[model samples]
Target chain A: MVALEFWFEFASTYSYPAAARIQAMADQAGLTVVWQPFLLGPIFQRQGWHDSPFNLYPVQGRYMWRDLERICAALNIPLRRPSVFPRNSVLAARVACAFAAEPWLPDFVRQVFHANFAEDLDITKPDIIQTCLERSGISGHRIIERALAPDNKDALRLQVERAVALGIFGAPSFLAADELFWGNDRLEQAIAWCKVPSLVGIA
Target chain B: MVALEFWFEFASTYSYPAAARIQAMADQAGLTVVWQPFLLGPIFQRQGWHDSPFNLYPVQGRYMWRDLERICAALNIPLRRPSVFPRNSVLAARVACAFAAEPWLPDFVRQVFHANFAEDLDITKPDIIQTCLERSGISGHRIIERALAPDNKDALRLQVERAVALGIFGAPSFLAADELFWGNDRLEQAIAWCKVPSLVGIA
Candidate 1:
């Protein structure tokens, strides 16, 4: 079976919606999904952006908020803008790197996205990250401390670099073999592509 | 029956997809779709943008092309990037505006969008626009001449201004009563919203 890779950033609001639903949708479509957590900050920095492109474009930002509201409402998901415009997702990405191979990685990633967008929490702060981990019955302190280890940090950076090399510049990017599908809106097409027989050999 | 307003720009790629399927989809959902053609160039100029936001952002532009490819493929539609983007859709918009009350306005708009994107035609040029119109069995020369009339130009400008007033900053915006859904992806939600009794009052 061809497994699709989903690259997401915890701080991305649209990624939140996609991460919350992709697993079930993929399962229904008879596809395997591999969740990959990466930091968009480094990628954006390389592009000479200090902030999200949406934030840089006021018109886009406004339209994005409204567009998200309607999309969330339709999906029956609760979403609120984060208090911090762009939360420090470094810690979250680090933890994600450590948990990347774990069975709970998808759940953990979903919680982080939900906390950052729906609960409007500052995901960058250790306290909030710990709280989220604890609520999920995981050792927040131990996992977080391990995530800060040199090897783990290196792993996270490598993931970001890999994304850049793969021509990825945005979050919630899906990879079906060699084809990269960027943005949450393309999630459906990404899943459908995985179902095609032609994609099996490519992966 | 509540009427859902579909505000589309001729140069919009995704609008082509939505415009092609929206009427049938709305019919299945038991809602009415009103096609409103407007020029995004005027709106962008008013907002101080010299080009489409996708073109201004390189990463976005690259992703848009890939995303459009995936989307069009999924929908079994052929799409090719136009050579001259941000095509002076002024003439097309004028023709669309003049035919706003026509029963075939939706199909006409879809053909124009397909011509611009799928056929890779310079929709801004009168000859190309005329060819598309002629193929659609409409009087290309007559429509083009009438569309450029003083009154039609003023109407198109007013339509653009109205879009801004309605808080729309993008193409393929859908309005179901007072609620607005932006982007071609939101067409389903827009149709669903039109079915709600409470929203019907706003219409």
Candidate 2:
């Protein structure tokens, strides 16, 4: 089975819906899904945006919240507007990065997303990260300690650089053999590209 | 049965595919489609973008082109990269705005999109606009004169303000009542919103 890279930012609303279903889709398509968590903060800073684009552009922001609600409804996923928009996702990203190879990594990723989007928890807090890690079957503060290790932090930084190199400008981007597809809507297309790449002329 | 307002910009690459398909979708659903031509230039300018966001962000721009190619290929639509990133669309927009109520408006719209995206013709050229209009069965330069009238130009300006008031920040946006759905991907959701507004909990 060909591998499909799922690039997501924990703070991104669309990535929530994406995370909820990508595993099933990958399993069905006989493809391996590699979940890569990255920070949108660095990328946005490069674009001169100090905040989420939703906050930077209020009209789009309002539309996004509404759009997200509708999408979550359609997908049968529970969602709530967190009091804090784009809660600090560094710790969440670091956890995912540190445990990228663990079989339970996707489970942890979803819990982090749920904590931020559904439970409205601050993902930056160590307790929240620990809870998510524990829910995925990992216990104690050691996991969080490993997640905060300098090497793991550096790995995530390099991953964001790799994402930029691959021309990713948005969250929930999918990469099927170097070809990038942006947005939650493109998940199907990316999967298709991985399953039947020749049809898209993707060599 | 209901009205779907399709907001488009001739210079927007994504709008090309959108213009090609929206009419057919509207027809099949027994809906009225109101074709709206607005300048993204003015809107983007307000956002401090002097050029197409695609031009300002080349990484995204590259992904967009490849994605567009795949989309066009999927739909069996022909496309060529225009020499100009975003040709001055005012003339084409004025023509669309001038003939908004015409039954052939959608036809003219598709032709203009095909001219720019498929034929790689400069849509801002009078000859090109005239050609598109003529192909849609309206002959002669008289229509062009009417399209260039002062009131018609003002009407187009008013229409753009209406679009902004409606919270449209990009092209290929659909408005089902007060609900704004952005992008070609959202077309189906917008239609569903119009058809079954109840399921979405949209009032």
Candidate 3:
């Protein structure tokens, strides 16, 4: 069976919708999903972007907000625009890295995405993150502390570097083998590809 | 039965994928799809954009090319980067407008999108467009002539103006009732929303 990897950033709004739907779709298609969470701050800084591209372009940002609302409403998901643009996602990414091997990692990532984009919560705050982790019955402090460890930080850096090497510059990216699908909307195509390996390398 | 409108532009890359798949998906969902082709130039100009957002941002443009390749491969679709960036789509848009009510309109739009982005053809050339129309079993001269008619030009402009009024600033936008889904990736969500009228206007 072909396995698909979902590389997401907690600070990304579109990742929220992708995360919420990817697993169910993958299951229906009989594919394995690997959740890989990485911070987009490093990538954005490398590109000299001070904020999300949507925010950098006002028109794009306006359309994005409305688009997200329509998607959430159709999916029957609640959403509120975050007040703080581009909140610190380093801690969240770290927690994700530390729990990558755990069974609940995917769920944790989805919850964080929802918390930040749907509930409009500051996912970077210790209390808010701790509460989110506690709700999932995990030790937030332990996860955060472990995430800050030298090895874990190095691993996260390496992950971002790999993404750069793989030609990825955005969130909600999917990797099916060597192919990359960027954006939340490509999630289905990514999954569909996993069902038929013969379809790879078409052009 | 609910009718959903798919508004796409020829210069849009992702629209090729959605245009190819939407019909099959809509059929499965028991929904009617109204294919609407409109020029994105007016919309972009109205929003103060000189080019596609991808072209405006270098990093985005580079990543988009790579991402499109990966997606095309996964979908078993042929794709090649267009030689010309932002080809003058006026002729193609006009032709599309002329055939908007015809059954072959969807195939024409799909073929043009694929030809522009996949085959790397010069879509602005009348000969190339004429050839494409001929291959699709449509009258190239008649369509082009009708496209230039005063009424058809007015209709195209009116369609673009309507898009601006709807707050759409991008191509590949899907509208189900009053709900709007932006981007090629949102095709599925837009179709799904059409199934449940109660979800409309909730956003």
* TM, every model: 0.89, 0.97, 0.79
lDDT of each: 0.81, 0.90, 0.80
Colliding pairs, model 2: none
Each candidate structure's count of clashing pairs: 0, 0, 0
Q: How big is the positional error of residue B151 in model 1, measured in Å on the Cα after superposition?
A: 2.5
Please write out the lDDT profile of model 2 over residues A1-203, one tens digit for every residue: 79999999999999999999999999998999998899899999998889999999988899999898988888888898999998989988988898888999999999988999999999889998888888888894998889889999999999999988888889999999777899998998898889777445432
- Span of 10 residues, lowest total lDDT, candidate 2 chain B: B194-203
**Candidate with maximal DockQ:** 2
Instruction: Give the chain B TM-score for each candidate.
Output: 0.93, 0.96, 0.93
User: Candidate 2: where are CA atoms >4 Å away?
Assistant: A199-203, B199-203
lDDT of 3: 0.80
Reproduced native contacts, each prediction: 0.16, 0.42, 0.47
Residue-by-residue lDDT tens digits, candidate 3, B1-203: 78888888888877777787788888898888888888888777765678886887676788778767766776777888888888888888889887787888877877788789888999998888887787788878877888889998898899888887776777788888677888766776777668764545443
Please give the ranking of all candidate structures by DockQ, highest first, separated by commas. Answer: 2, 3, 1
DockQ of each: 0.25, 0.48, 0.33
